[model samples]
Target: MTSGWVFEEAAIVFVSILAGIIFFYISSPSVKHEKKQQLEEGTSLIINFVLFIWAGKIVLNIHIFVTDPLAVLAYPSDAHAFYMAVLLLLVNIVYKATRKQMYVGTVLSALVPIFLGSAFLYEFIEAVWNDNTMSWSHMGLLFILLILFLIRYEQIRPFTMTALIFTIWSLGQTILTFILPYTTLYGYMMSLWFLILVFTISLIALIYNKRKVT
Candidate 1:
């Protein structure tokens, strides 16, 4: 078989695996009451992350089908998909391990920022070192989706912390954009905006949670 056939086969295999994973997770049995709630929330996050990956894949697949098979390789959104998949898997594992812990939310809130911040920083480095361009529209859509998730989850305090950090990062990126005029800087700005948006959503979540508690 030729290289083109090999590439197509690989894509089919990956899509099949992703679909199977989603189906298996969704069909899994519910845990006990409190654990079930955590599972539900984590599942929602996984679903949204998968949806984002699927959307990116759909766009890339369309370009590949119409243009060249190699066109799919031109854009490297696969890294983001892989990253989200790993995160989902980790969340599932952690929730199962720590379900009995009462301060799960507080623990998660503290850890999530560190984990996500690292991912963001890694992506930023990749964008700079690999000479990747910024996808502002995609980032904007992601930001909106994250905000919606925060609203739905009603998690506030952690979200507020995320928002403040993101706002500062975004402002710094905006300033850098004027001074640097580099593609990497532009990408950083896009990422910073998305981060800020995530933070804002977190703030909303914090407010909702506070109201519920009081």
Candidate 2:
């Protein structure tokens, strides 16, 4: 791959991380006092995610890596790598929380905004910079989520925010898929059943959590 392609990929990843961190800092006032800790957590998560992506890329192209490590490094990661990164990120969170190294509620509050912010910015960059105007539909949906989270974050009970955001986002995207040519989770083209399933799962989690608290 050319240097330009590598630069763009790096730029997108950088923008995604920055957008998430910026959003986390702006809306999560509850943890404002723990800014350093939050920043460190976010940074760690982002770093791990990027590393997972690289790991995914290498594993997927193990033959090439075995033959020429530098060549494998030059290649951009794909949808599968993206999914691997997400899966590992989730696993990482669960492991930490189970071990009491992390708090679910606090991490989630920060995670939700970062996710939305990064998603919005990623789509924004895709739609504007990449001229994939079809992505604007995604941008619009994410913007609504961002607004909803920002508005209700202070009002919602802790720990429920992530479920709420996921439910709303999945529901919106599921609907958008019917009207638009396509929809993406990050840059990956996702299936309708998967989106609907995500909505259902998120809704279940939201209900279960709310009931538990009440």
> Which candidate should be chosen as best, given TM-score against the real structure?
2
lDDT for position 67 in model 2: 86
Give the number of the best model, judged by lDDT: 2
lDDT tens digits by residue: candidate 2, 1-214: 4667977868896888687898788777755568667667767877898899889999989998998998888876777787778789989999999999987776676677888888888888888888998788888888888888878888996578888888988888998889988888667776787788779988999999988988
Clashing pairs in 2: none
Which stretches of candidate 1 lie above 4 Å from their native place?
1-54, 60-63, 66-70, 78-112, 115-156, 183-214
Estimate, for each residue in 160-191, the C-alpha lDDT of model 1 and write its tens digit. Answer: 44444444444444544454443122122234
Residue 148, candidate 1: how far off, in angstroms? 26
Worst 10 residues of 1 by lDDT: 182-191
Any idea how many clashes model 1 has?
Answer: 8
